[model samples]
Target: MGRILLIGGIGAGKTSIKQMLMNEQVSYQKTQMLDFSHVFIDCPGEYLEIPRFYHVLIDASHQVSEIWALQDATKERSFYPPKFSKVFRKPVIGIITKVDLPKANIKRASSFLNYAGIEEPFYTTSVMNKDGVAPLRMRLRELNELYND
Candidate 1:
């Protein structure tokens, strides 16, 4: 099983993506523990809580294969908070969520990526519209295949 870490600021649609993947309703009270699948761990926690929680998982059997940065494109460059980059050495992919939102600018999206020091291509996704999930899934599956190889 591949462990996918969903990291982002509050209200960046992490839960929406998780719900889309699971095909179930998103609820904090119900899924506080963790959601398991062939592809994800679905640990949907705020920025502060993630560090401590991730360290505990350090001694666990699974290692995080990918880190998905669920970013809000409409937000300013300063809005992208600093993350603990030392946590993982694997691939970290930036995902610009809420693509269906009106007034979404691609320039801001690129700026956000530059500010985050990410050079890889990011997905402009809207879980509400289902525009970008398929390509992302294919990319993720490719990553999983590479990891196994």
Candidate 2:
């Protein structure tokens, strides 16, 4: 897969999903700054929450092949404005995290992602339980192929 960038609000499972994708030590650590890995680039959630910080994401987008706009199903909030993904030059996808949470709302999460301008079918993943990530991996592979072609 080509380098992928993970963007989302705080506690939206960006770091956890990165661990799952990288097979790294699965633990929670608040990303203080942009954490670059071989497979993914994880950015702080505050960047998405504050419009002033969006420039960080815009700049980082230039370095990656794809952008994942994530939202946690467990918590519903409008962090992204209409068609926010369009801000990035790279292809943008949506991911719904914490799908295994007790009160997770997948439908609402999909709506939020759609509102944020993710054109393809958004992924729903539960990093803790290791569920639904395979599809995402497959999708990433597909994206990589298209990007390379």
User: Per-residue lDDT of 1-149 in model 1, one digit per residue for the tens?
Assistant: 36676666556677778777667765444235455566666544544245556554332224567767667766554344344433457566788887787867766876666566665578888877787988877877687787773
Cα deviation in Å at residue 97, candidate 1?
0.7
Q: Candidate 2, residues 11-99: lDDT per residue as tens digits?
A: 89999988877778889899999998766889999999999999999998888888988999977576989999888888898888898
**Which stretches of candidate 1 lie above 4 Å from their native place?**
25-38, 48-62, 77-87, 147-149
With a 3 Å backbone cut-off (N, CA, C), the pairs that clash in candidate 1 are none
Taking all chains together, each candidate's TM-score versus the true structure is 0.71, 0.91
Q: How many residue pairs collide in each prediction?
A: 0, 0
TM-score of 2: 0.91
Give each model's whole-structure lDDT.
0.63, 0.86
